[model samples]
Target: MTDTPKPWRIKSARTIYNNKWVMLREYETVAPTGADASYGLVHIHNLALGVLPIDDDGHTILIGQQRFPFGRYSWELPEGGGPQELPPLEGAQRELSEEAGLKAAHWLPLIADVHLSNSITDERAFAFIAWGLSADHSFAKDSSEELTVRRVPFAEALKMAVSGEITDGFSLVMLLKADHLLRTGALPPELAKRMLAGS
Candidate 1:
């Protein structure tokens, strides 16, 4: 006989709380081990979006702001949330322009459908590497956000991510993946050459 992996089976579920942003639900589940337990799930309603805007000079943009949940200031890639119905690339472009005042002529999907915190929340994230950027001065910052933008060499940003200075999971993942793609020649030869030049 062959053994097959079995997933947790939900016996019953009910919403405990819900808001515009997220929904909390309680579930009675039977584990693969046949043990019964209760699980709390947080379902995020929006798709998380992230953009690494790389300029012609091989620099990337970072945004610094006070993250309310962490109760501390954090420096991370340009990120925002988009409606679940919106295409990920479109969302990335919007976030990049809104947060960094830059628009990209080319975009490559870096990571797709990444479950940010799967153990507790169904929060997923998508990221893109954008290049051939131009400034858009008319872009306005989101009224609720007060951000500080910095343009740094791509190599420096990767170092920051590696050193834990850029602790935001989404940003860290994107930076590391970009570094990998560039080193492995997975990106366009011309772009990869320029990116590695700054390293």
Candidate 2:
């Protein structure tokens, strides 16, 4: 047999639950082995956006808050959801400002598209590296969020990701990728130079 694989044949699908934020659907399908099976999928109504904001001194921002679902405090890169109608980059920028009170003059996408929790959810994420940052206090935090913002050295953030001190999957991916980019000289010369200079 050739390496090409056939797609699963979907017999039927029905939405079991739907709200403004997410939809749950169940699908009856025929597997590649011709076996009948059922699958459940969670469809997120918005795009997941995350930003790693770095300043000229190689400092990155982290936002802390108590995660309700997980029942624990989490420190992560500034992250939020973007409506499907909005561009992912715009959403990232908005989250950077709202969550951390910072804005960037330069933005580079770190992770273009990631299928977070691919097995159970159709949730996708876009992450970015933002530099040339400055304070922007006009935007207010969301009512549901009580955030504590911190600016830490880039190396420290990377360590947090590696040590599991920061458990958010999106944040871990972004920080690890940024560290790789910086170490490999993959970033633009000027930006790399700034990011290498620790505060």
Clashing pairs in 1: none
Residue range 71-184, candidate 2, lDDT tens digits: 999999999999988889999888988999989999998998799899899888999989999998667889999999998988888888889899999999998888889889
Model 1 alpha-carbon drift over 4 Å, by segment: 137-139
Q: Can you write out model 1's per-residue Cα lDDT over 22-92, one digit (the tens) per residue?
A: 99999999999999999999999999999988887888899999999989989999998889998999888
Ten consecutive residues with minimal summed lDDT in candidate 1?
190-199
Model 2 TM-score? 0.95
Cα deviation at 42, candidate 2, in Å, is 0.1
Give the residue spans of candidate 2 off by over 4 A: none
**Residue 142's C-alpha lDDT in candidate 1?**
84
RMSD of each: 1.6, 1.4
